[model samples]
Target: MDRTSVVEVGGIAQFIREIGPDEGASPPLVVIHGGPDWDHTYLLPGLMPVSLHRHVILFDMRGCGRSTRGLGPDGYQPEFVVEDLSQLIQALGHHTVDLLGFSTGGQVAQLFVESHRRLVRRLILASTTAYAGGDHYLVGWQEYERRLQIRAPRPAWAECRHGEGDRGVRGTVQWALDAAPIAIWDLDRLDEYLALLEGVTFSGEWLGPFREGRLHAWRPTNPEQALRDFVGPILILHGAQDMGFPVQVAQRLHAAVPATSLRVLDQAGHMAHFDQPQAWSSAVLDFLGG
Candidate 1:
């Protein structure tokens, strides 16, 4: 695996990692991380299985993780994030490629497919909502709000009152991780996942931007149109027990996208890849026709 940085739209440098196959490959699969605020680290390990089939490209979105910060106000919006993805794809020299998006990343993926349908070959959406509706779509929003209230008395929270500091956002992210229902998967893997998250460094400058770009803060302009318009093959993987994006959202998405196939992992949650690797990987590989 090799890592490189590329400047996308808005001049935000995105941290991209590539896992090349033994034989040089063409048209690599691009994996976009979720959390608008979270990094790509969590998905890195889960992608090891997919590397055997095709080269994999994983990247952190602008203002998150190792990516450059403060692309200004225009860069903080959801539409801009989709534009950044489009720019990154073009810069990488690929006219079209397979796409895998998890959770919030699915929003960007759908938007990209809608606007640039010809650029997406196959699309895989996991543990995500088709639109911004109810608490199901924004599961962590209330949790973050609750944490902010709890930490209001702290100095770090006080520092966030000025609007640009990351204290509140970082604290809220950590709290959400802590509060997430522990998975019943392999205990060792769960421990490793928790440790990786604990070591992540959140960008202070992305705090406000991340919060402002949340699905709850912005209404879904035309999700149905986007879904119905995209013609590429699509696979929807949902966890039966996912608390963040309810299974209904996945079903709804499958219904909207005429060329979609849906698979529900019985024992999985928001992190389906981690909770059910064998099932999740098999479904993806099958969809990819390997």
Candidate 2:
């Protein structure tokens, strides 16, 4: 049977939801979520299909979801996150496990794998990028803005320190709502995804810094270059129509990392799991074959 509870790890209470058998499985799959302001809820439904047979472990990072925050932006550093993951795995009595990271979560997984190379068995990077983008960093967003022709100014996270009036979870949700159109590639699925997101509970602790676009979380100095020695299975999944990171970014990442495979799902966007559930899960399941 699946398990659900909160475990205090690395000086914080982390909320965990497990699906499928915990033992006699190949290896538990740990899913790291994205968003400085979001949680793991959006991923649970899409990944449930795979969890039916394999142990699926999902948790809210400190300062997100129901997890208790440590302090503020300083507490949300990448080092602390790596420690949290390491301690959580040990607490669960797992010496090794497969990891699936989506978006910012992928950044976390990559950082963890880079540091604790021996602990992770496989790595799945879905709809994520390595660094914050290089010379072409703002190209995609610029194109999107041009197409949108929005008269209203985009919310600047760095400037909105006040958290858009409500200096709490609601403000973070506001950021989500504002970034939705830029995040989702498939315009038709925007409303449905937004509806699902409405029920998601976000953390207000880090909302201010996150809204300001101040991310001190892990980012690769050179993503592919950093993983030169990594020997584990690496799967790079991207949406063919992704506007945020774009498919080209995925291609470069795939090319840089050795022993990595890339699969681009058509008609998908930044949130491929929501935009193309069947295809997204199928690729993940196939890569994590039992």
What digit string (tens of lDDT, one per residue) describes model 1 on residues 1-290?
56566655557787887875732544678887887677777775567787777788888887777887766655576666777888888888888888988888887787778777898888888777777664545456563344333321223432343354557455556544554443222334545556556555455454565557642332246876776677878889888867677778888877776678999998777787878777887887888775
Highest-lDDT candidate: 2
| Candidate 2 overall lDDT versus native | 0.77
lDDT score for residue 191 of model 2: 65
Q: Model 1 residue 105 lDDT?
A: 87
Each model's TM-score? Answer: 0.80, 0.87
Worst 10 residues of 1 by lDDT: 149-158
Clashes of each: 0, 3
